[model samples]
Structure formats: structure tokens, C-alpha cells
Target chain A: MGETPPRSANAGTGGIRVAPGHGQPAGASARVAEAPVSTRTPGGGDLGGGGGLPRARAFGAERAFRGLTLAAGTAVLVIIAAIAVFLIAKAVPALRANTANFWTYEGWSPNDTAPEFGIGTLAFGTVLSSALALLIAVPVALGIALYLSHYAPRRLGTALGFLIDLLAAVPSVVFGLWGRDIFVNPVRDFSVWLNTYFGWIPIFGGDGPFGKSIMLGSLVLAIMVLPIITSLSREVFLQTPTANEEAALALGATRWEMIRTAVLPYGRPGIIAAVMLGLGRALGETIALAMTLGITFGISFNLIENGGNTIAANIANAFGEANDTGRGALIASGLVLFTITLIVNITARAIIYRRREFTESAA
Target chain B: MAKRVDASNVTAYYGAFKAIENINLTVEPKTVTALIGPSGCGKSTFLRSINRMHEVLPGARVEGDLTIDGQNIYDRDVDVTAVRRMIGMVFQRPNPFPTMSIYENVVAGLRLNGVRKKSILDEAAENSLRSANLWDEVKGRLGKPGAGLSGGQQQRLCIARTIAVEPQVVLMDEPCSALDPISTLAIEDLMFQLKDKFTIIIVTHNMQQAARVSDRTAFFSIEKTGDPGRLIEYDNTQKIFSNPSHKKTEDYITGRFG
Candidate 1:
């Protein structure tokens, strides 16, 4: 079997010689001789060739599976790189054509001859609105999450969890329409009430016409982001180890005390990640803000006044009638938004990574 | 300070399934009592019921009287947290809080009891660690995460945490099953020392372990599968091992049958 010359000769003549010897006990020997010859020829062998053919086929399949998964992983990176390159290529010409400093100027008029525009006010509005939204949403979301994970009966918790997931699936345009129509009157009255009693504070000190303002936009954004944060944090809280909870109880902790000691500490990183994800959604939200905000073009800390704008809402509002420079400017603003989201995600990842040593060893 | 444990006509259940039936035992203060049994025999269940820890699971409950120093723990008006505080438990698996430092782990019980002064916390942490026989190995690394320790050290840290509040009783549920031989020996030695200050009740599958460490041994077994476990024999460890009165106890100790 080890001689190459004899094997080659046998491969050519063995099939023909084995075909006529089926009548005697020598038939078994003849079939074995033909089997090795046929199996050695790769794809030409039948599955009846047994061990070697199936094993070789399985090896080929394993290699093909690995290659497919590798390609899938690389596709995501390729798409991200392509987007960044295209955004930069389109943004450079718009920046070069502008007569005003892109970072400091407060007005936006990219359709004019000089195309003087800047993102200073837009960036400010975007950050302030999202931060305010987070302030309103985070506490409520954590309360709901804790109730769902630890306090509610199992059936009710499951039902409430499903309802929260459904909330996340609602269209943003519907939220915009609802905020502009039904929610605006109550918010206007509340703003008037605030300005009456506590107008000394900068954010609450607006003069008049408090119906469409930054506060309204932030409230709408908070409503939109609440379900996402609640669901994700609930998942994290539910994953607290039973052993750790038992340890706390055996140490004489009350129910709330057990949660404070065991559940909250274990869910810290997850809560941070969930909050950052909600912040990302709030920052990039457009239709809801466009409908709810006054869409002014200046930097002001008055949250209850009728004037605010963000990078994404500006892009959506201006992109309809924009010329070449205007479109490029909008794309440039999109690139800035993209960069902000990227920074937020990377910071969240760094926070998680810094604590991996503790979490992993415990696992 | 140690407290005597008295159980009369105690039975436990998980929803509709009876786990242990009609157990009666008295454990003297400052003595080690070992509960030996086969798998699914409800020895651990009985031990958890002593501290009212069994009811933490949904639908799990116990019936009859379990008393500590003549006060019934199962009385309708008794506070469960106070019961657990007076009777501490160490689990089979060593579960030190993964998020806390070694010093924080030791002081966790005290913190739960609302001890806020830093000097008091520091003193309790040191004393508990020393009593658990872990201070010498961990004194230099009090700031390190509790999970960074070896398995045996983590178990000892859990012991220290349990004792920090000065509980009158301590329960161990196969505390050395997940440990190596050397760690097992160290825990056994610590148990001998701990018997001076706290009432200790332990559940074990290892017969030799029960014989070696316990003052009194209770043998638990079941009639058949799906039946509740019963106390087959209760005697001094020497009498139970050397000359058992019941045939089933003799058979289990000699390794003839579970």
C-alpha cells in the first residue's frame, strides 16, 4: 500500500478487474482493492467509501464555514470605513468654500454666495437637549427596570417587559406628531408655571411663547429613549447571580438592602452602557425634534423659549431645498454627529474594559 | 455568645412537594452538630430552616416550631432579618461579594446592621478575619477584590463576613465540598475553634468528616425516591459510628448503601 508505482497501476486497472469477480469469496478482496483506489480520487468516490471520504468532506466544510464567518466580520469594518471616507470627501469642499470659521460662527446660510455657516450653536443645542433628556429619563428608567427585574411578580414582569419592548418599536414620526399636537399644551402650561415661580434660573427664565421650545424637544426625546434604557438595564439587573443575592440575604440584608449590596453593584457597568446607548439615540433623533423645537439659529441657555436646533434636525429641515454647498454642509454636520456617537461608544467600551479584570475573575 | 437550637415536629415543603418530614432535634450551645445524609435527603433544607433562610425561595415554607434560646423563630410577629442576623449561614459554594474588597467583605454584615463609624468597622473587620483564621494571609491585601483570593480563602472570607455581626449561631452546608484536602483540613480546624463562641450546625455527605468533627451526629435518609427525608438516628458521634442502634444507620456508615 505504501508503493506509489503499484498504487498508480492499481488505480487504473482495479475497477475493471473487480467488476467480473462477484461470484466467489474472492469478491470481498476485490472490493477492498477497488475501494481504496476510488476513495483516493477525491470527488469521484461514493459515501460508501466510509471513513476517509466523509472525514475529508467534513474538513472541507469546516474550512468553508470559517471563511464565511471571517468574511461576514470583515464586511462590517469595510462598510464603516467606506462611510467615513465618503463623508470626509464630501465635507472638505464645503469647508473650503465657506467664508466663516466652521467652529465659532453662529449663523447657518450655506446657500449664499459666501456660504457662511457654523456648527457652534447646533452642537450646543444637540448636547444640551440630549443631556437634559438623559437627566429626565435615567431615573425613571432605572426605577422601572428595578421593578421589572426584582420587585414585580413573574407574570406581570414579563407582560410589562413585552410592553416596553413594543414601545421601542414605535415610529419616531408618530412620536413627533403626538408631541406637536397633544403633548404641547400641557408642556406650555408647565413652562408658564415654572417661569412664574422660578424664573430666576437661567434654563427656566423664558419671556413668552413657551409652546415649542428646547424643553419640549428634550421631553419628547426622553420619552423615546426611556424604553431602550429600561429594557437593557432590566436585563442586566436580572443577570445578577443567585448565589450573591443569597449571600447578602444570609448576611441579614433586607430586600432593598440586598439589592443595594448585591444587585446594584453587579449591574453598574450595564447601567452605564444602557445610558450611553440612550444618549446616542437622543443625540441623533431628528423628526421628533424638528416637529417639537422652535428651530432657531443662536446659542441660548433658555430651555423654555421658542427656539432650539440640533445637527440632525437642521440637516433634515435644510436638506430639502439645499444647493451644492448646502448639501455638503449638511453632510459635514452629519459627520460631526457621527464623530460624537463614535466617541460616546468608545468611552463606554473603555469603561467596561477597565472593569473586565474584576468581572471576569468573579465569573 | 452561643444559643441552643430546638426543633420539634419540623417539616418543610417546596410548593406541593414535601422535602423533610417531622424532624425533632436539640442542639446544645457551643457544640458542633453534624447532619449526615445521602443525596436529596433534605439535610441542607433542614439546616436552612433553622435560620428561616428556606423561605427565601418562592413557595418554600416550613411548619412546626424552631426556637433559639426558647424564643420561637417561626412566630407570626418575629422579624426574619433579626432571625437571620442571630443565626448566620455559610453556603456549600464560597460566594464572596465579587464587587467588594476583602476588608469590605468582612464588614458587610456590620454595614447591614447600620454600623457607620469607620473605627468600629475597622475593628470588627480585623477581629472577624482573625476569628475566621484568614487575617494572617490577607492582612497585606485588604484592598484587593474578595474574588481575587483562592477558593478556600474566599470561603473563609465568607465565614468572616458571617461572624462580623456576632451572630449567636453559624450554619455550614457542606462548606468544604468544593475545597481541596488541605483547604478542607484548614476549615475543619477552624470549626473546632469556632465551637467555643457560636452554635455550629453542619450538613455533610462524608461520614468520616462527620465522625471527625461533630459532637453529635444525626443520620437522615429517605424510604424511597420521591419520598420525604426522615431522621433515621440521632446519637453521639462515637456511639453512632462505633455501634449504631439502627440497621439503616449501620448500613449507610459502612458504605453498604446510601
Candidate 2:
């Protein structure tokens, strides 16, 4: 019998060869001959493998599994690095050809002979619109999340949570179309009402032609991000330990007070992560902003004005008529958007990490 | 500051399933009363009902009469928060708020009741920690997270937090079940001191623990699986342990049956 040789061979074979008589002609003989030998070895003896169990082979399977998973884990970093390299490579040429200061010039004319464009207005618009959207969405999202997780009956919470998740699944294109054809009118009227009354507030102080303005764009963005924040926050809230909540209740806390003391603090990191995820969604949204926003280009704090444009919206609006230099300029803006999101994500992670000691001790 | 707790024909249920049926016990002010029973025997359930904490679960409820110092806690208009405030509880597992510092956790109950003065909170925190026998160990690190303490110390911190609000009655649900023997001894000693200021009700699986610390003992048992728990005997700790009248209580105390 090929006993000793098979033991060494089986070390890397992950026990598949030990399936009695599957494909190997010597399978039964190999098993019978290896039983006594396996019981003498340290690893096999631990499993009491005198009955011809494939102990060495099983050990090999675990190592093989770990190697496979390691590769899968590394693939994500590799792919992200590849994307950053591609973006930088494509963006440099158009940046050199530009006749304007890329960081400070507010106007974009990449298609002209001496292409002149800057990220300044686009960057400001992106940050302003997304910040406004978050301001409008976070409180409402948190309210809905708290209601779903703590206040509603279990069955009702499940059903309503499912509906909110469905809203998240609705395609961005559909949200864009709804903003253009259905939701824009009410937003326009509301914008006019704000201008009529609170015009002193610079954000709400734009004149007529306010239908397709930054206000409309941001409101649409707010609606788009609301479900994302709500669902994520609800999950985090639901995970708050029942023990902590009970401790609060036992200490004479009202229901809301229990939430304030137990649920909110425990879920703070998770909530911040959710908000960042929503912000990421708001920042990257393109078709929705393109369709909803008035496509004028200048920095203005008057949100109801028809003159705000974000990087993503610019890329969508410009890509169609773009020359090679024009394409590079759009990709360059995309790189900037990517960097911004990267910074937002890193900051969120840092906040979560700083609180790791408390969370870990909690577990 | 202690107040008497009276439960008459109190029945608790989880949705349609009855947990404990018609439990009647009176705990005297400033005394340590212990509930002893086997697993699934409703000792913890009965303990929770005393502070109205039983109803915190989604489908859990209590019926019949329960009173604290002649006030019916189950009255329709009685504020549940006030009931809990008057009757504080310590759970089986130590649950110091993970996000709060030691000082903050001790004053959490006070803060909830709208106490914002730092001097008041500091005094309360120090006083409560001292009473719990934890001040000497934790005084230097009051700013540290409460969860950073050892298991025994965390349990003590939880005790401090519970009593910081100066509740009249304190309910402890197997407070030492998770601790080592030394930690258990420390908490048991704290229970003796705590009985001087608050009415304390404790539930324990360790028969010896009930004998050692309780002024009075109540035994709970169920006939079989799925049956609601019933009180078999309640008497002075010495009488219950040495000369229990009920056969079931004797059998349980003597290790004949669970």
C-alpha cells in the first residue's frame, strides 16, 4: 500500500481524495493502511483518527480556504488602487492644456481651442447642495428611524421598514424623472413663498425663474438620500443592546429618555457612518441633479437662483459635446469628487475608530 | 428613606403565556429579601414586577395589585417613570452605560430628572460609589469609561448608579451570578450595607447565598415545563432554610429535587 507517500500527498489535497472509491483505484486500501499511521502522528492523534479518518487532508482544506479568502480580501484594495491610477492618468493632459487656473477659475470652456475651466464653482456647488440636502434629510430620517425601531409595533415596523427599503431600491433615474416632471412644481411654489417672505436669508433670496433651481435640486437630493439614512440608522438603532435599554428604564427613565441615554450614544458611530453613506449618495448623484438643476455656472449662495452646478451634474451635461480635452476635464472633476468622498469616508472611519475602546468594552 | 413593597395576587405574563401566578409577598423597609428558585421559575419575573420593569418587554404585563408605601403603582394615571424612580433595579449582568464615564454613569439618573449642577452630581457620584464600596478603587479614574472596570467592579458601579438617585427600594436580579467568588462576596457584603438605606429584593440560584444575606426568603417553583411558577414558601430566612413547612421547599433546599 502507498501509505507514507499518500499521507504526504494528501497534506495538500484537502481530503477530496479520501472520498472512498470516488476516482482513486487505491482509495479503500489507502484508507485501511493509513489508519494506524495516522494515530501515531501528533495532528491526526488529536482527532483520534485510528479509524482511518482523513485528518491531514482536513487540515489542508482549512489552509486552502484561508488562502482563497485572503485573495478575495485583497482584490478590493487592488481594484480601488487601479481606479485611482486610471483617473489620475486620464486627468493630467486636459489639466495642462487648460489656460485657466484649475482651482480658482469659475468658468468652464473645455471645448474651446484654449480650454479654460476650473473646479471652484463645481466644488462649491457640490458641497453646498449636498450639505443642504443632508441638513434637510438627517432630522427627518432620524425621526423615521427612531419611530420604526422603537415606537411602532413589531409587525408594523417590519412592514414600514420594508417599504422604506423599497424606496431605496427605486432607481436613481426614476427619481430624476419624478423630480423633473412631478415634484418640481411644488418645489418651485415653495421656493417662491420663501423668496416672498424670508428673502433676507441669502439662500432663499433669488428672484423669478426659480422652478429649476438649486433649491429644487437640493430638495430632490434630500428625498433621494432620506431612505438611505433612515434604513441604515434604523438598523443601528435596532442593534442597541436590550440590556442597556433595560438599565435605563430601571433607572427611572422615560421612553424618550431611555433612547437618549442608551440608544443614541450606543449607535452614534453607526449613525455617523449612515449619514456619511447618505452624503456619499447625495454627492455622487448625477442624472437627478442634471435634470432638476438649472444649468448655469457661477458661485451663488442664493439657493433659489437658477445658477448652481455640481461636478457630477457638469460631467453629465458636458460629456455629450466634449472633445478629448473636454473629456479629460470631466474625468479630472470626477477625480476631485472621488477624493472628496474618500476624505468623507476616512473621517467617518476615524470617528468610529476613536470610539472603538468603548464599543469593544461594551461587547 | 426605605419604603415597604407589597404584592398581592400579582400575576405576570409574557403575551399569552403566564410566567408567575398569584404571587404574594411583602418586603419590609430596610430589609434584604431574597427570591430563590430553579431555572424558569419566575423569580426574576417577580423581581421585575416590583419595579414595574416587567412591562418593559413588548408583550410582558402584570395584573392584580402592587403597591409601594400605600400607593398603587398599577393605577391608570400613575406615571410609570415615577414608579421606576422610586424603585430602582440592578440586573443579573452588569450594564454600566458603555459610553458614559464612571462619574457620568453614577449621576445618569439624576441628570434624567433634570439635575444639571456639577457640584450636586459630583457629590452624588462620590457618595453612591462610597456606599457601593467602589470609591476607593475607582476615585482616581472617575473620568474613565464604566465598562473598563473588572466584572466585579462593573457590577459595583452599576449598584452605585442605581442608588445614586436615592430610590427608596432597590431590586437586584441575581447581581452576583456573573462574578467570581471574591466579587460575589464583595457584592453580598455591599447588599448588607445597602439594606440600611433602601429596601432590597434579590433573586438568587445559590441557596447558600440566600441563607447568608437575606433577612427573609421566598421560594418559587413550577410543577412542570410550561406551567406558571408559584410561591411555595415565604418566611424568615432561618425558618425557611432550617424548618420549611412545605415539602416542595424542603425538597428544593435539601437538594432532593430542583
Q: B1-258, model 1: which lDDT tens digit per residue? A: 999999999999999999999999999999999999889999999999999999999899999999999999999999999999999999999999888889998999899999999999999999999999999999999988899888899999999999999999999999999999888998999999999999999999888889999999999999998999999999999999999999999999999998
C-alpha RMSD values across all candidates: 8.4, 6.5
Model 2 Cα lDDT, one tens digit per residue, B93-143: 999999988998999999999999989999999999999999999999998
- Candidate 1 ranges with C-alpha deviation above 4 Å: A1-59
Error of 1 at A143 (Å): 1.4
Best by the DockQ measure? 2
lDDT scores in order: 0.91, 0.90
Itemize residue pairs with steric clashes in candidate 1. none
**What tens-digit string does per-residue lDDT give for candidate 1 at A39-99?**
2244323334542322222333446878999999999999999988998999999999999
Assess the local accuracy of residue A118 in candidate 2 as a C-alpha lDDT between 0 and 100: 95
Candidate 2, clashing residue pairs? none
**Residue B69 of model 1, lDDT score:** 94
Per-candidate chain B TM: 0.99, 0.99
- CA lDDT, candidate 2, residue A289: 95
